[model samples]
Target: MVQAQVTRREFLKASALVAAQVTCGAWLTGCANALAASAPPPAASDAPAPIATPTLSRELPFSGWREVKYYDQLASAVVQCAQCPRRCVIAPNARGFCQTRENRDGKLYSVVYGRPCITKTTPIEKAAIYHMLPGTQSYSLGTAGCNLACLYCQNYTIARAKPEEVESYTMTPDDVVAAALKAKTKSITFSYSEASVAFEWMMDIAKVARAKGLKVILKTGGYINEAPLKELCGALDAINVDMKGFSQTFYDQVCQGELKYVLETIKTIRRENKAWLEVANLVVPGYNDDPKMIGDFCAWFKENLGDDVPVFFTRYEPAYRLRMPPTPVETMERTYKIARDAGLKYAYVGNLPGHTGANTYCPKCGKLLIERVGFDIKQNQIAKGKCKFCGETINGKWA
Candidate 1:
């Protein structure tokens, strides 16, 4: 199938038009129409093909290797990946734990650069980032790897596979920005899988999106090193970090990661204060649903990330390697109360549609500010980022 490449000139024109619309307070209807009209149509033979199932294939394309940053070359044709805490020491022609970065003749390169296995325009809430751009759509995409090995990964089909094992479409940074503009989305998100595995691709696309006055949101697992995490925070407008569980033992056994690094990543984001930060913790039954553990988690969250930061206690379903039953609704309710009692203003229970906990309320007056059912926003009472009833300032990006 033929692929269309967007030229730099076309990107600049599209970005300029979007900027003008934002400045003049014009509706996105005209801007979207302009972008669609200017964009080149797909050739008749270039219709998108169905995505392939993940399987080992030697014939898959593997030529897209771009030099990676934040790595140290070691002796005897070995390299250490500094992108994440894993710090995988890969020998020549070997791959890191993520399986997306490889060592080619002692040089670490990203094999999934500009090759996205999934792309769609989805509600921001679906990313579990309930605060930023609440009701708006975000152009979301992800590559085919993850830094962690979570046993119950929902997207394990691609996240657990090697880059060459999945079918992907090549999209440059300009192509991604153009697609977002054409879709009439004001933000771009790197989601679905562990986006930290495709750090280079996301960073490049974020740079272009930022220049076009579009926000960049990362729905990540928060497993990166300090240096790279700080660098990524520079271009990010918002982030929703998944905090899996509270115990170090749980992390080591279930996620193949450590609790300290994830906490440090959250701390780094809060310290930088450059992006809107939100956190979610999936409550697995009989695992992390202990009342004491929940309370401890909430207390630590309140102390480290502050009480204003939104925290979500989501129900976990059986998937991947885990055979556990779905979390009980009562467990989620209890966890929500625990978070609220810990002084968190916006504590929520996710994965249970139509629950009262899904709505955002005013912390001071206890007035319902945003009414939501699942990912859809039914009513929003917060105007100009302030509670309409008590006129108290809400902590989020609302326009």
Candidate 2:
């Protein structure tokens, strides 16, 4: 085990920083650990005074939450939706599959903006981003709702909830940026829930965050349409796309989504060269961890996304509708070998932290370039994005 130990209180502190950032400087001690809110509005250029808002410290109104309009009206009074592949033709008062977007009287509004149900400051490594500013903190934010219904959802409590059941607060896009600045975090991550489901809120925040020079990392399922994803790509700094399995049958039966769309999203990220993209494949015990299947996935990734792309073989835990046994550590190691044999340069195991595979090594010299004990960087051998031992160019953002 890598032994990256962090106290629960420290985790709470990180969560507090994330919450304070999302709430626009609103700090209430009692329920402060709840939802992650959006950044507060920016201050006037000439005004020296501080911009402050009344902090309603409640569990509801998760920060970084806001409604958006992404549809355009046609001559026949019909609106074309441009959010996800499931371009839900929502009628007035209807909601999309994610159950967050509401079609109110011919217009669409995201109901779960600013208010988030699942709010916690987790290890950035938990986001499985092994590269792009390693060993730094990211203010994680998300609201309730998901576009796809994966049977093995670890966060179904909030991700699958209706807007009515979860507590929410209103934080504008500016609020999200302000929170990022106040926390002095290395970056902001759209995670814990499906970011694509909250496309407008995430897209808006990414633009503002980029202007402030804060990196935006997306932890997504990669089940989005091309155009909207392309639009968001320009503002994104890095992305971790979940590739559930290698087959369409696995996607259809296990995730209630499509495999090709996710593959397309990964391809778009690489083709556009907009974001530093990584892939995570959650290996369920009996479902998608077959040796041949893993080899095919690694082979495809090597061919399309390249061998330099980081791939994480995440272990599965029983949750949501699926109550299968937890994925074995041996299974993770086995898949790692399969991927490495398939010509993938960077394949790591996750969820069982402290494993040797969690570390990053240079493919050229076979030296440990980055040693991570959980989320903490115990040793770093790379300097300025190159291997220190042999000057091998590391394939990541290394500033």
Whole-model lDDT per candidate: 0.83, 0.76
Report residue 168 deviation for candidate 1 (angstroms): 0.6
What tens digits encode model 1's per-residue C-alpha lDDT throughout 75-182?
999999999999999999999999989898889999888877676778889888877778998888888889998998999998998877876656778877877776
Residue 89 alpha-carbon offset, candidate 2, angstroms: 1.6
lDDT of 2 at 135: 81
Q: For candidate 1, which ten residues in a row score worst on lDDT? A: 49-58
Off by over 4 Å in 2: 1-69, 72-80
Tell me how far the alpha carbon of residue 23 in candidate 1 is from the true structure, in angstroms, after superposition: 32
Best TM-score among the predictions, by candidate number: 1
